[model samples]
Target: MEAHALYELLEKYRQGKCSPEELEQLERWYASLGKDRPDSLLEEGSEAAQVLTSRKLQELHASLGRERRVVPFRKRVLRWAAVVSGLILLAGGARYYFKPASRQGELVKEYRIPAAHSRHITLPDGSLVILHAGSRLEYPLAFNNNIRDVTLVGEAYFDIRPDTAKPFVIHSGSLRTTVLGTAFNIRAYEGSPEITVSVTRGKVKVETEQEGKLLAVLTPDQQVVYNNMGATAVRQPVTADSAIQWVRKDMVFENLSFAAVAQSISNRYHVNVRFEDEGLATCPIRASFNGTEPLETVLSVVCGIRNASYTIEDENDILITGKGCLP
Candidate 1:
């Protein structure tokens, strides 16, 4: 059963609307969770964990009846915390049971992309993720709770599956982005000067995890840049597709200088690029590459555009020489 379904069933039980069979099922599921190992709930201060503890305590009090001496609220909360933590840990197993016919679990899985390479992953919920070079994504094998949560490091593009009842969330460094099934790109590489999130479809809510403060709510073609050094964020309009150009391996240049173009190429191909003449660095380039073409082919075209020539040395270093662009 999905998290939303379980939530609805619990609500019905609370309201005394469950049938006898349904009540039995709920009791069985709760008993199974009670048997889970302790030490699993890591986010004790989180709202969700608090809610779980409260609910467990209420159920326990109801079961024990007024004849039994009431435990202090503080003591009850501590005991329930252990129980809920065990439940969460059990949720990470490959198969946890609500019943024989309805087994569910959300085991965590992680993926990492090496330098100079990219990878594509289809999550358990059918969300598509394109992980850029030097990035890592940690997601669950299944989404079992009220939220779909994942963590990202470095850069990645997400095409999320829409489920209004469960918001998809990405935790990157200190930033948290929440969306209800949208397409977006995030760049949050460690040690980077800034973290940027750009939306292509639907909307996204960005926040600071530590303070739970809202930073920006962005729509299509919108982006937010968070400066790590200044601890500030700014929103701006941007061409959304351009933000994910690397996913398609499409190199696009619109009136960019040779220096900028060289840097882009160096980053993509993991090479060092240099202009032999300082003047040539200022030459403008207007071009597009599908990335299917060889690096040499792309370089030849760029050099040809400015009446320049290039030489490859030591397999990874590139040198360009030319008379600067037309005056």
Candidate 2:
């Protein structure tokens, strides 16, 4: 199932509203999806080994009755930490595993991206994340009973799996996006002038880092853009299909400026692209091209449509100069 459909179906199942057939479909879907393993098999001392140990612990705890033991929360957490640490040691190489590292229990595991490189990741709970270049995501390896949370730096598109009991929370720089299983996009690159959250499906609540700032709720197709410029604007919902067209290797532009389009293309292709002429910076253009297309071909097509001209300087920079340029 696609992300949105899976989310909806999961939500319905949780609410006791799904038909029997739909529930079966949900089970089938869950079983069909599995994590991608690296080349090396996980040893008992590896991180993955520790994860398996943690899962066993969870199974043991589940068998306990609601009448419950009198174990203190702190002690319980520490015990789990030790188990997880030992497992990581078995899963990964033993030399790097430290007990302290286990205590750093992340509810979502850490996600890393190389400079100028974006990546698609699947969360432990089956949610999806598209991390922009040079971004990091810190989440616990697994979410315990209550809140599901994650911290993000940079940009990502989220296709969350619905589980109302565990509302998904994203801490992106100074902003937070909260949802009970929704699809959304967040752009909060460090040093970027602004933070943005655009909702494509379901609903999301956004709040500023500073307290007392009222939550901003977004409906499908809506976007919230906020920055220190004292500007917080709500815009008519743009089609998320267009916003995330990069996922398909297609770059779509509807009256987008040359500079903006170039930035997006750069991120998509993991390349440095420069425009030599300031005059072409503000030029408005409408076009769509696969990201894998030759850079020269893309520029040529855009220039041809506008009756303009361009020249590549040593294949690194492109200069577009012409009368048709809209400044």
Cα RMSDs, all models: 21.4, 19.0
- lDDT against the true structure, per candidate, is 0.71, 0.62
Which digits, one per residue and each the tens of the lDDT, describe model 2 over residues 11-100?
354333678788678546433323221223245575545444444544543432221244442233223332333333332322223223
**TM-score between model 1 and native:** 0.46
Model 1 alpha-carbon drift over 4 Å, by segment? 1-106, 250-327
For candidate 1, lDDT tens digit of each residue in 88-194? 43333222212111122233455655457665577778888877887988776578878998889999989998999999999898799999989999999988988
